[model samples]
Target: MTRLGDGVRLAVGTLTAVPVPAPRQIDRAVAGVAMALGPFAALPLAAAAGLIVLGGAAIGLPAPAVAALALGAVALGSRGLHLDGLADTADGLGASYDRAKALDVMRRGDSGPTGIATLVLVLLVQFGALTGAISAGHGAAAAVVAVLCGRCVLSLCCAKGVPSARPEGLGATVAQSVPRAVAALVFVVAAGLATLAPGLPWWRGLLAVAVGYAAAALVLARCVQRIGGITGDVLGGCVEAAVAGALLATA
Candidate 1:
């Protein structure tokens, strides 16, 4: 496969449950492209979410139930990857003051009290915000935007200058791989296109984008402060937080 093809496969394979051939080689360039295209790579999940919203709306399903279904699809589609990341990051954050101990806690597969609590809180907020948006008649738009938000922030997280918390693993491979300009361009395009959402005010769309990215930034800042840099888990936390922010803003 060509290098760009390798990047696409890497993005889809890692970001979603969809099976794709793993890249034969991984380097900074390939990793950068993968992160840059992360949002597009997740088109399947985003489209599934948007379709679920439309279908539920047509059937006059309860908004909350519809929202749950959409989110459940997203979680399953991605193999609950971000959810696992969010939980691990939370556990690490709440584990100890020592960086090594915190890292070790995150490395463990088990979820602790802090991780479980964090998951509950985040999932509740995500569901509530999406339900509200669906009720407001922007169900499809909200679903698509929220799902896109989850992946689009990957570029920003991997932008050049962001340090990896560890010397090895997925985080290290993609960390600092995206150029600042490329990340900014992708973000701008996503925000600019939000005006196309049905019945959504252009200003509101822009604000939603800003709010979503801002939420991701806040999570990233905290992770950096706590862990000295980001791990794969921290990136996952950012995605969930960004999704919630977008849904809340739309609602």
Candidate 2:
């Protein structure tokens, strides 16, 4: 039980700007455990973002503005870590098809034309889909579902079959940390919650889950084929892509 609490603390501390203290020990096993618990840590952040969207809507804000606000809240809460990952992954993959070159580009910490383009396109799609959902009176529900799906994909990325692209760093520490069964269980719970999200039709909720899973899977497969395995950036990219896909489905 103490270990579980520590894992949760580690997850929340690392993944978000939430005010949780660091765990007493930081090791591979602890990091792996934290990755498995990531979905739970994301719940409060998602709820906060959902409330922001709903509140903005209640004040008669435009759908696009409200969606942007919600996105801003999420980025602030997570310190834009995921967004950074997304941009790096895009730049690396787009700069070259060569695996080593791609990895090198990703390590440079600077956005290239392809990275900038990818970020712009993805953010636009996310904003557009969120605006559509809000216009349809599903802003809060869509926010929650999208955020949950995004975090859930992290578990999938860490599943036992997934390998790390590098020998060191976060990607390797969390690589294969989550058992396939655990990933499946997280997905089942996420899907069930999606079905219960307020203002979403059951069919649409299911579709959101399906789209999120497919997007994550596609990204994972491509990363594995291109880079030989997953990286921290790849995981981040998967989360954003899954969120966009889920929100689009809801819309």
Candidate 3:
């Protein structure tokens, strides 16, 4: 039988996007396809963005609903990766003064009031931006662009100078394994095109890029200073935050 141990190792390596192939190659051919997982991560958000557009068109759904649904899409696509970070960061930041305590709080699986509050705030901001965009009569295209931009921010974050916080967490794995240039190039071209889709002023796109990057940098700086480096959750929060900033700029 194809050994389960070998299978697990292969799967982990692939999901982690590690270039180093394992010696005990599992019969799990699916392992090879794992290489695409990093890029494929963008699809869910894109789908969610589409759904928000549909929601907007069908009844001119209020901004809150569109934002909620759109944020839902981002959550679905990311599988709550960043939300996890947001939760952990909240718990960690809320409980302790030093770095170690903060890290420990975050590492714990249990949620606390801080985590809950953080998630609520993040979702609210996301929804507000979606509402503003829709109200501006941008249609689903704005949602799509925001989703694309968010992913692009994620890719850029992973690709750039920020190092990983944990040795084995998702963020570090991506930072270490993925080809920085290819991933970054794909995200930039895709996001730039998507953000410009609304046919807004050229200045709007530039503004979004500038504002998004600035916000991301500040957040990243905090993550690094607070807990040593960027975590997977930090990456997700950054993406959502960037999208919010982008929508606000466009709005």
> Top lDDT: which candidate number?
1
Tens-place lDDT per residue, model 2, 1-251, is 66777789988987889998878886666766788788788888899889988899888998888999999889888998888898999898888889899988988879888888888898899999999999999989998899889988888998998899989777888888887898898889888878887899888888898898899899889889888788888988999999899999988
Each model's backbone clash number: 0, 0, 2
TM-score, structure 1 vs. true = 0.97
Tens-place lDDT digits, model 3, residues 133-213? 677776466666666565556555565466777776655655433346745565566546654665556566666655666
TM-score of each prediction: 0.97, 0.96, 0.73
The segments of candidate 3 whose C-alpha lies over 4 angstroms from its true place after superposition are: 1-40, 176-191
Q: Residue 8: error of model 3 in Å?
A: 18
How does model 3 fare in lDDT?
A: 0.61
- The collision pairs in model 3 are 63-131, 67-127
Winning model by TM-score? 1
Greater lDDT among 1 and 3 belongs to 1
If ranked by lDDT, best first, what sequence of candidates would result?
A: 1, 2, 3
Question: On residues 1-251, what C-alpha lDDT tens digit does candidate 1 reach at each position?
Answer: 47789899899998999988889888989999999998898889989998999999999999999999999999999999999999999999999988899989999969999999999999998899889888998878887887887788999999998999899878899999999999999899889887777768887777777888999999998888888788889989999989989888998
**In order, what lDDT does every prediction score?**
0.89, 0.87, 0.61
Give the TM-score comparing model 3 with the true structure, all chains together: 0.73
